[model samples]
Target chain A: MPIIAAQGLTMRFPRVTALDRLDVSVEAGVVGLVGANGAGKSTLIKILLGLLPPTEGRASVLGLDIAREGAAIRERVGFMPEYDCLPPDVSATEFVVHMARMCGLPPPAARERAADVLRHVGLYEERYRPIGGYSTGMKQKVKLAQALVHDPQLVFLDEPTNGLDPAGRDEMLALIRRIGSEFGISVLVTSHLLGELERVCDHVVIIDGGKLLRSQAVESFTAVSGVLTVEVQDGRDALGEHLHAQGVAVRPEGRVLVVDIAGERTYDLIRDGVADLGLHLVRLEQRRHHIEDVFTS
Target chain B: MSTSTIHDIGYRRYDGPRLGRGYLVRSLYVHNVRAVWGLGRPARAKVMPFLLAAVMVAPAFMDVGAVLLTDRAEVLMRYSAYAIYLQVVVSIFVASQAPVLASRELRFHVVPLYFSRPIAPLPFVLAKFAAMVTALLTMTAVPVVVLYVGGLIAKVPHPLTHLREFLLALVGCALFALVIGALGMAVAVLTPRRGFGVAAVIAVFLLSSAVVLLVQNIAEFRTNFSLAGNAGYFAPFNLVDIVQVRLLGAERTAEAVPDGFISGVLALLLCAALVGGAVAVLYRRFRKAGLS
Candidate 1:
């Protein structure tokens, strides 16, 4: 069963409509909600979490009606907001324990879960230090630890990789994937960067200007294209000219030549052309369509 | 050294008993109360509240000391008039701590985290409101209790009468805590910045008391005592004082208090309105903040 289902969900602010007749149903796994800023990603999450009432239509989370059973739904869900919401004065352990209690965990259970989740998030001895002194990467880890400390069935992580460096971003993405696969928790993570989501999400839902643009599996969005990418050590211009004379559709894309595949002959033609030119072959492989190509196309 | 393998227990799901809304509210209330006292926080956060609490209880200790030394009943401070005597300290305590309880979450954008849980906005606001009231009650009642206990130790005459006055003064403290806590929270929640919240809370108390005192003095100078008494309702300290003097049979501390049983009932209703109105405002404020 789909963990989240929405129908004609609309959110209208006075000056602008944040969401317009949006409909989306997502199965449990690592699902990505991809949208630009002001594309109603946060609004849709708020509606799904039952924090905001929709102007029209209906939705359900974990098979419970969002309009009526929000409390019950929230009982099983965790949320990590995009903005900086941690109080700087308290240590990470203290804050996460408090959040655990907020989710109705008993005192002992709250403390234990807080410790366990902090450890899982790679925060050990430094968890005792005040969050005010934490780096941006450490703070994000703390935020993530609090969300998981409650032992939720599903978690909503809104832009969890925001404000992180490249290494931190990769670590956060890996952690999010583990949350879905190893932790056995369904994750609905949002990001504006499609490439990042492509790496972690099993299904990607793209929205633009408060409307659904596309919703498909990650494999479908990144399926192998019918073009081959050819790279050579030298004589790149000669290779392109030779491939063109052989009636092969080829174009130079930087150091590589993009050749439209004409059956299996395209590979043989590239191999023979490189051999005849005495140019060392670096790579010859079919290019897969990227998630970004969906937007550009 | 022998090679050892690290164990990976993995993430464990909590299949234990999950408590209900009441438990969540209780946890939030406890957390807020501790925050108000700066417990579980840095030592620097503890300094202001502890210093103010010491300042609050010092005079009672001095009064007890004087009674022990002089053996005179008059040396003991009046029970109902204790808060009024140390009104500045109480106000400072409320001003400083109200922001700690009311605005900390708002300033840090933590309200959404709470609302996203199973708790509703009303209960969230009520828990905070209750925490502020609890903090204020403890601040005001501890000294009065110390004074009473010290009096008993010092052996003031008519122990029963002292007990009755002490009980009535305890009631007065509740009223004071409720009214002042409500007003301070209402003011502080509007200012999300801690410094601004503190300034705003203190300014509300100071400005309202000053205006009411000015009006009371002018009315008394004109020999319109009833008008002066009615003006006392405008200030939070004097509002609760009216309830103490008129309804609880305590000695009047304010310059003038409205006469008769009807005035006392009206003062009680006004106190209720203040608390109810503040709760409503807080509910709306937090609900809006949660969405933001």
Candidate 2:
């Protein structure tokens, strides 16, 4: 069964329709929900977690009815919120251990698990220090740690890297990637930055104004630009001419040749042509369309 | 990959009203840790009632010797209601904030994080009340010990009187907190905004007190104050005055301790009704928030 499935989900807020008629299904991998603020990413996550009552439609997580078995579902899932919420005076070790206990872990087990998860999230040495005293990066780590302490099956991270600096963002991202890959936890992570999600997410779901724009694997997310930039050390103009002579559109892009091979057999043609030219092809890469294309469209 | 693997890390048991103990206790821990000397990251959060007690009571310790030497020592030596006093405040604050609690969690980004797992919305509300009560209960003890010990050092007379007050104070404090807590929580569940809920609560408190007195004062009865069960409704708010009447055993007021006891019971029932309503509303709101 799919880990999560939603059919015609809708959520209405006082000010805006936070989620429209959206449909989604997931089968256990790190899926990134990419959207701007108020795009209904948080709303969708809540519905799956059985936190929000949808205005319309039905949803299920881990093969359970989201409406009826919400508590059952939540017990198995983990969540890292976007804002700073850890108590300033409490140590990360104490907070996470407490969370683990709440998740039904016995005292000894909760402590052991809390310690392990905090260490895993990169708060190893500083776990003993009060979370309030910790840096932003450290606080983020504690949040992540508490979510993982109970060994949940899936984790929903709402803009996990929201307020961090560039370096902190990268570290948080790395930890997220590890959560999905190393810890074997399925993640439904959301972010405004599509590029960041692209690097780590196995699958991507894009939304705008609470509506789905596209949902596809990372491979399908990247669109092939019209022009493939080709570079050769000795034959640049000659290569452009050779390709042009063969009815392939080729334009000189400085020292490289931008070729238009718009066919499934383009790779074959490029290979054969390069072998025929008696020249080394240093670079033969298709220009990737930026994520902004989806927004612009 | 395997079905067994899925079940290993999943929530398969489906049941009704499985209260989430984790969230209930964790909420308390969060409140406790947050308020206990202001210890976590979200540093700006106050844990208000805890701080309030410390601020209100700390200065009283400085003049312990002087107070012991004076006649006013009786009030200080009356009883250790430190726990009761703190609990009352905590209960009041908790009740006042209930309506705003759900909204705050949503606003502060804690709701989604809280929801992502098998956490039910009802637990958060219940847990919050419990946390506030427990936190209030925990902090109330410190001041009692401080005051009690301070009295000894100062050699105050009738130390037993203070101990009696302390004992009664626990009962008084619990009744006070529970009564106010139930009402505040109900109001909190009904409201959405923190400020609105808080303001509403303050208004309720001020208004309730005014109305209670207004009714008592203006009513042309055979007598204004009654020592019977009919007078039970007004006892909690009028506790100090009731204590003055009952303990002093005046002729006009009932000389029986049972009269005082009955009043406490009736007030407790009122609190229960309010708290029960508050919990029910929030729980429903939580379910709606979680499931469509």
TM-scores of all candidate predictions against the true structure = 0.97, 0.67
Interface RMSD of 2: 8.3
Query: What TM-score is obtained for chain B in each of the predicted models?
Result: 0.96, 0.66
RMSD of each: 1.9, 8.3
Q: iRMS of candidate 1, one decimal?
A: 3.3
N/CA/C clash count, model 1: 0
Q: What is the TM-score of chain B in candidate 2?
A: 0.66
Just chain B of model 1: what TM-score?
A: 0.96
Displacement of the residue A226 alpha carbon in candidate 2, Å: 8.3
Instruction: List native contact recovery per candidate, as a fraction of 1.
Output: 0.82, 0.33
Model 2 regions lying over 4 Å from their true place:
A208-211, A221-227, A232-246, A252-256, A262-282, A286-297, B1-112, B115-119, B130-170, B180-236, B239-292
lDDT of 2 by residue, B193-216 (tens): 677777666666556554555555
lDDT tens per residue, model 2, A121-141: 666567777665788878887
